[model samples]
Target: MKISYHSPHEPNCSICKKQCRFYDSLREHLIGPLPKAECAKQFSERGCSLCLKVFPTAQQLNNHRAACQSLPPLPAISGLRPSLVNKRNQAEKEQILEESSNKSNISGIAMDCEMVGGGRDGSLDLCARVCLVDEEEKVIFHCYVRPPIPITDYRYDVSGIKPEHLMGGMPLKQVQEKIQQILYNGEAIWRIRLKGGKAKVLVGHDLDHDLQCLGLEYPTHLIRDTAKYIPLLKSNKTSNSLNYLTQSFLGYKIQNGTHDPYEDCVAAMRIYKKMRNEDHSLSATEFVPENGVYSRMRQKELEKMSPEALLQISQSDFYCWCMDSR
Candidate 1:
């Protein structure tokens, strides 16, 4: 007698949901033991084989592939081109000089420029006027710079330069030069005096950037940055804000509306004077230069010598010391 073996539920093709001859065959198809020829053909017809998403045309599929493999476009070469680079540089230099010349009348002006951002890409947009005071602490020069870059952030509201002010403002190069001239001229006057007597210092908080922004080179020895003297803030703390330092040292809070450059410059100078005064009062010690290998060997030999021999060598060195001092 013949017997039929059948599952109570008929097994169907996994890909198409069509009934198959045997459960084993259906299992093999579903488990992918044997490749589905029709499914493979269907996948080949569509552009995306993995997802089987079809595109209208082969060109669209090729275009998508090209896009996936393509790289981003690079920035336009600003300085390398023969046509535009030199002209741009000359324009920038002239603009800087013009601004500096315009602000020449202001005595000891302390100016700060606010830019759209901090990095190289960001352009200067606002200027904070700082009028330098005399020894009595009176304002001598004050004026805000209207920036050219559009202000996108509301945080600049405290900077006291409105959008209306910047709408018809000058280029940043001009403003930067103006600030530089004010600072450098103030420092230069004292430097010239020091040439006949003692060196005068250009004092500032994080002044390197300020000097750099102005396109001026300052002697490292003559310049003093307040940010450097306070070791605790340099090593331990993250923030070195002028506001925090001024409040801590001067016992006065910087006003919230706009940063006064004059006040900042004064604070920096005060800090520098304090440090210098402390330095001058310290006792001096003789500094010995490291001797050559032969000298070092001689030193070791001297160390091994008897007390009488060492004393004799010391006496001989007295003549050498006198010659060196002369």
Candidate 2:
């Protein structure tokens, strides 16, 4: 096997192939004040806003953006703190929660869980705490859970879960029922499953594991797992940790000391809302046929199609949050 010696951190410009210290620098090279003229123009026509990669056609770029996280408009993530609540501000936080709770018809919510360990080796993940937040990053539900099995490993360093915390906590079964009520609103489970009830979209990082630990079932269509999101993955197509994704994209630090499910919940919600907030106005010309239909188009036929027509025919591998706009 051959080993390469170049610095892997430095990436090349997608259009000019110029070396840059970082992806941001490469992006600046194409779009900054002193940008390369040809690359700038080409990028403007077909560049992916999130990845900064140039695609072959505008339609391809549009398809790529569908799977990517939308641009972050918030202030720099570093200068920002996690908004730790102190005794003085506790009332304010409670007031905010009360205000948030009054708003019905919440279309989306993000959840995060902290786990303690069970089993002989203390390797089994047992949900010890859960937090859910609405689009406003207001706490909708937060609880420490009493696991069915006895706690073997507290994992206090990461989870901050202590025995006394679960002393008066809600039982797992009760917790599950409460969550379903909030998610489904007043609709019956069958209405949500079969009749397309307005069940709130669940957003989280590695949500499959969270949902499994909770022993809850939601339609896959309504769950947005950030870990499984295509654009949030590494270049090698591996999952990025929530901390890494938060810092890299959202421009801040999280999971700083002890893990707070509320903080994680807010971060995940911000990412989802940002991605879903894109103004992807769909025209009559912008519609893709049903699955397995577009691939039948011949190469020559695809070449002759207009960019909008090509977009109309193209399909995304994952259901993009942008579709939530519809």
Candidate 3:
């Protein structure tokens, strides 16, 4: 093939500019064709000579010789120093176990609130009930808190809680404290373990709001939300109500008409456990990087996963970012 060069100082070669069959003959008249042997050596060092990208030095070029375009992209975590990452991973694992141990033996709690039909401005009506359950699913604590706002929806059809139920109920502050006490008491044993170590996991459905409502902050790793575990439910398909996951996973229909604090708590814990088991299994698999042809093929398979699945993989702490970056 003919070759052409552009330079303001030198006159252009007609034969080189034209498409010629003999590159070697033209090479004699111009800068000689890159020394074949040298080009091959550079190829082993710098990559395709035709690409014309320069390496910092010949040494770097030599190192690039083994480079292959077929390799899979490096994982995101690969950029992290291996020694530092290992230490952080070990620390996180220890923290999880310590938190689990601290919270494990403690019973779970469920909460439900009744509100009026006054839109967002409307205040919560009736009592906000909290039910604390032990391992056997028995309620250990239950109480109702009278809200500060007036009850506008006294119609029996709207809120099942009647004015009579509020008569003997404690104030909202007292109710909140009582609920906190029960939770604190149940977790006291774990706290001792945690003091010697760390905190335990808290299982709940839409728990972020609940924890906020209760004025509590739970550790992110310890807070397991059933809503996050099943992305399929969250995607534009169906409502992520506790009732759906309960019926789908546990095969038990719940929240038919009124809310049951005890039942809701049990369901949340059950769902959390199930999802945790699945995550554990996925974590056990060994990750391997393919080389040459196999690397390209494996990468194509990974690309086939749904965007959501790929995102989950990308976010995973186990995945090496350095590997993904490549």
Candidate 4:
């Protein structure tokens, strides 16, 4: 998706180029405040949309793209998972087992869940389907889950899950066990002593909700949530929707039709990988804080640190699972 840049009146950061409200200035032109050091680093190395080449100057990018060959479009992805549970069998189970078995040393896997309402008012979320994908975008596990409570709302329009779909769905406990097995690489969670362990990172958007609905818990350090990633947030410092982040950052559209957990999983993984590829480049002397208290520090304390040091100690406005991972 292309960003609209028709308005020159709108203020934008000189370094990061993100449009935002401007502060009063006598010069009538200040390109807004200087962006955080990390943001400056990112904008300086931005890739050209037309040619996929990184250029230091917008003029250079434009000139290069004018004569550059366009890259081929990626093929459409499909067969992510079945809409019905009857289609699942031993073959599918074996495929998941094989994939999980191979991930003992892998860095992380992405996950997404579809939920149905089950409370009296059909207001409580319950996990109905789950999808997990590896770094290569291969499906590690995907299955429909039976909610423990009777589903008051199948949320057919949103989730595409009907009553028939859950008839043969895996029990909630079984689904939870399978997901835990895949995430933990079959090692018991309690036995994993270190932050760096057999446990693989879990990538997703709004993962707390997904894990809550699924009734599963994972180490904070092992979760990468796109919605809470600091640099990916909107100008207002609010979390962006997964669909917006996918189209705006990853150059694709998803979740337009009835929600597909696998598609969402892939999108979340792509965003996380994109962020992971950045050169944050903090020095060993610049320590990252644990309890996320940097933002609450007094202005005097903040002013004492250099911009790079500030960036090092800064935390996401929201609870980013990636924080613990760092």
Model number with the top lDDT? 2
Model 1 misplaced stretches (Cα beyond 4 Å): 1-141, 166-200, 212-217, 230-239, 255-258, 279-285, 288-326
Candidate 1 per-residue C-alpha lDDT over 79-99 given as tens digits, one digit per residue, 9 for 90 to 100: 133223223355664564444
lDDT against the true structure, each candidate: 0.41, 0.70, 0.44, 0.65
What residue runs in model 2 are displaced by over 4 Å at the alpha carbon? 1-102, 281-291, 294-301, 305-313
What is the descending TM-score order? 4, 2, 3, 1
Q: What's the TM-score of every candidate structure?
A: 0.42, 0.68, 0.46, 0.69
lDDT for each residue of candidate 2 in 1-326, tens digit (9 for 90 to 100):
11112222234567766655344467568888899999999998988655577899888887876666433333222222223211226577456455544467578888888999999989999998887888876667676788999989999999987786777677899779767877777468998778877777889999999999999998898899889776566656678888876775566678877887877887888777766764443423323334434344454566686754544344434555777877
Write the residue-wise lDDT of candidate 3 on 138-208 in tens digits: 44444444556666665344344556655554576765654544444434535634674333344567766
Q: Whose lDDT is higher: candidate 2's or candidate 4's?
A: 2
Alpha carbon lDDT at 56, candidate 4? 70
lDDT of 3: 0.44
Candidate 4 deviation (Cα RMSD): 9.1
Question: What is the lDDT for 208 in model 3?
Answer: 68
TM-score of 3: 0.46
Model 4 clash pairs? none
Candidate 1 Cα deviation (angstroms), residue 285 = 5.8
lDDT of 1 at 83: 28
